[model samples]
Every structure is written in structure tokens, then in C-alpha cells.
Target: MSHHTVSVELENKPGALVRISQLFARRGYNIQSLAVGPTERPGISRLTLRVDCSEHTIEQIEKQMHKLVNVLRVVELLPDESVERELALITVGAPPDRRAELIALGDVFGARVADIGREALTFEIVGRPEELDAFEELVRPHGVRELARTGRIGLRRPGPRQSRAQAALT
Candidate 1:
């Protein structure tokens, strides 16, 4: 199975998310990550979902999503044409002797130290999934106290011709 990312635009209603999730659940499709937020358009929200499934399964999932009520649009984000990011907050055991080293490692990944306590330091890192994975691996030996991640969010980069066409339309 290949990994797929899909962005869905839908009405901002109470049960919209539930219905969409149910569709996936009923189909036995596992969602690896999901992030939802309001869009610039009023009463509309965007959901970015990452799933591991076969190409045929993903096609079916998209078609099923289109049939759901309140769903405005569904688009598959091609990796080559998209920019993806995820946010992770990780707290690690930091003794005085290792504190500086931990800070330096975080610095290399452009991570910010969000909090520091007597025995721990929390870092906020925002980057692609692979970068976050590497950061986690490097810090695991220091004893991770806690970790939280905002699942992947992505946007497709429009081609130059598409950009020009959009500008002309506007």
C-alpha cells in the first residue's frame, strides 16, 4: 500500500466531520493523520488527511467522500506538487550536563525551546514528517518525557501556467 494525502473542503457544520470519518471507518480504511481548520471562505473548513491504502482504495475513498453531505470538494495532493508540514512538541529529560547538547540539537532542526523545567525541556518543532522523525530518533536516547504532534497538513503548489491563469481570472 502507498501513502496518500487528500484535502477536503466542506461546510462547517456539527456533524460533517463525524460523517466523513464514519465513511472511512465503515470502509475499514485507516487514517494515519487528520488535521482540520477553518478556511478563508466563511462557513467552510478544510480537512487534510493522510492514509495508507492501495491506489484503488484511495480512489474509492475520494468517491465516497464526494457523496457525503456538506462535502464541497475533495482533492488528492500529489507529493511532487505539494508542500507538507507537521508540528511536534516534545519534552525530554535534560540534566544540566546534557542541556546544552539538547539545545544545540534542537537548534540544528530549527526547533524552539518552548519550556524548560528543572529536569526537562520542551521543544516545538515544525517541519516535514521525515524531519520530525529524525528529530525524534536523535532525542529518544535522552529519554522522551512526552510528545504531541499535529498531523500533516499540505497544499499543492500550482504550476506557473496555473498561477498565471488564476491571476488572469482574478
Candidate 2:
């Protein structure tokens, strides 16, 4: 039941996302987080999916994704070898007297004050899932008004050997 992140490159066409989601639904796999966007290649899109499953299940899921018509490539992003990020927007109760304290707390987490209403302050935070969770926990006592979090997005980092080889070629 460990979390796994899978990155898929696919055709940027209508219903592509729906089809991928259906595949997971049919297999009874719940997606923990999913993010899809256009890639540098104009006609292709990259999808980052986070799911809780065993190693065997993830292998099967990758194989199934490869068989889909729209999917071009599928790869598992290992935590130690990949860079992952998530964005969250949180609005908390902020009275005039507590504004500075809230702002200081946000600064500790590298969050920005997106808005400062009279009774509420909105913060924009971008970081790993755990970082966002910690920020939320600390701000909960301030009375969270609303919160929205984007799915995790990840990119695999090149290994040392690959980097060395590429450098030599350059």
C-alpha cells in the first residue's frame, strides 16, 4: 500500500484523460493525485499520477497504460530519483491583530500571501505533499476557510552516469 508516482506521455486529444481514468477505475485503483498538461512537444501531453498500490500492481498498471492507443510512454518515478511538487492555496481566518503572525508562519514555509482580506488571508504554497500537509496542520488552529491543492507533478532526475555521458558528448 505504498504510494507510487507514474508519469505517462500521451497524445493531446479529447477523451484521452477520460480513457486513462477509466483504466484505473476498472482496475479498482484509487488515484491519490493526478496532474496532466501539455508537454514541450506540441501534440503530446504528460500525465503524472500518484496511486497507492504494491510493486506488482504498479507494474501491471504500467503495462496496461502502454497498451492504450493514446499513451506514448509510461514510467514509474522513484522517490529518490525524481523531483516532485504540488501547489496549494489556503485561506485562513486572519484578524488585523493576527495578520503579522499568520504572515510570519507562511514565510517559514516559503508561502506567499496571495490575498489579504479584512477577515481572511489567502496563501499560495508550492512544495512537496508533506510540506503542504505540515503547513495545513499549523494553520488549522487559525480556522481554515478554504483550501485547494493541485495534484503531484514529478520529473525523474538523470542518473550520475547519464549526466557524465551527456557532459562528455557536449
Candidate 3:
């Protein structure tokens, strides 16, 4: 089995996420990571899903997804072609006598100290999955009390508009 990333553009409406998630669950495919957010268009949302499945299975899933009424478009985004993919991680911690050290370390990864409290400090970092992993590893000894992360989200760069001739061919 190999990992595949599929991006689905769907209408922004209630129960849409549920319906899409249920489609995957019923197929017994394990989703490694899923991220959904609003797109540039108003009333539209993009769903980025990373799943583990064989190539044949992925093709089958793609065909099946096309049958869904709410699904507007489904595109398989290749890593090299994708414009940007990012993950956000938020960590809260308090290292005794090591605040400056932690802050310095965070600075190296472009992480920001978002909040500070008597018992803990919250740091926010945005980067690729590997970067986030490295950041967490670096902060391990510094006393990371709690953490939350939004897994990878990606978008495909839009291509030039099709000419009238090309559109007619389709």
C-alpha cells in the first residue's frame, strides 16, 4: 500500500464533512491526516485528505467520489506541483529557569511565543510536518506540558484558463 493525497472541492454546507468522512469510513481505509478549510471562493471549501491505499484502490476511490452530488471537483495534488503545504503546532509549557533558552530555540524555527501565563508559555509554529516534528523533538527536554497541531493542508496552483477551442473539445 502507498500513501495518496487527494484534494476535493465541495460546497460549504452542513453535513458535507460528515458525508465525506463516512464515505471513507465505510470503505475501511485508514486516513493518515485530513484538513479542511475555506477556499478563495465564497461558499466553497477544500478538503485535503491523506490516506493509505493501493494505487488501484485510490483510482477506485477517486471514481466513486465523482459520483457524490456535493463534490464539485477532485484533484490529486502531486507534492512537487503543489504551491504550499503547511502544518501548525501549538505547544504549552513552562521550563524552570529556561524561558530564554526555549524562546531562543523557538526563534530558530520561526515559532512565536503566543501566550504567557504564570505556569506555562504557549508557542505557535507553522511549517511542514518534518519541521514540526523537529521542533517538538527540540522542545522535549524543555518541558512541553501540552500540545495541539493542525495536520497538513495543501492547495494546487491554478492553471491558465482554457481557451474557447479547448473548452469546446471537452
lDDT of candidates 1 onward, in order:
0.93, 0.92, 0.79
lDDT of 3 by residue, 19-136 (tens): 8888888987778888899999999999988888998888877887888888899887665555435555555566557778888888999899888876678888887667888999
Better of 2 and 3 by TM-score: 2
Off by over 4 Å in 2: 160-170
Model 1 local distance difference test score = 0.93
**Model 1 misses residue 14 by how many Å?**
1.0
Query: What's the best-to-worst order under TM-score?
Result: 1, 2, 3
Model 2: per-residue lDDT, tens digit, 80-156? Answer: 66778899999999999999999999999999999999999999999988899999999999999999998888887
Off by over 4 Å in 1: 160-170
**Superposed Cα deviation of residue 170, candidate 3 (Å):** 34
Which candidate comes out best when scored by lDDT?
1
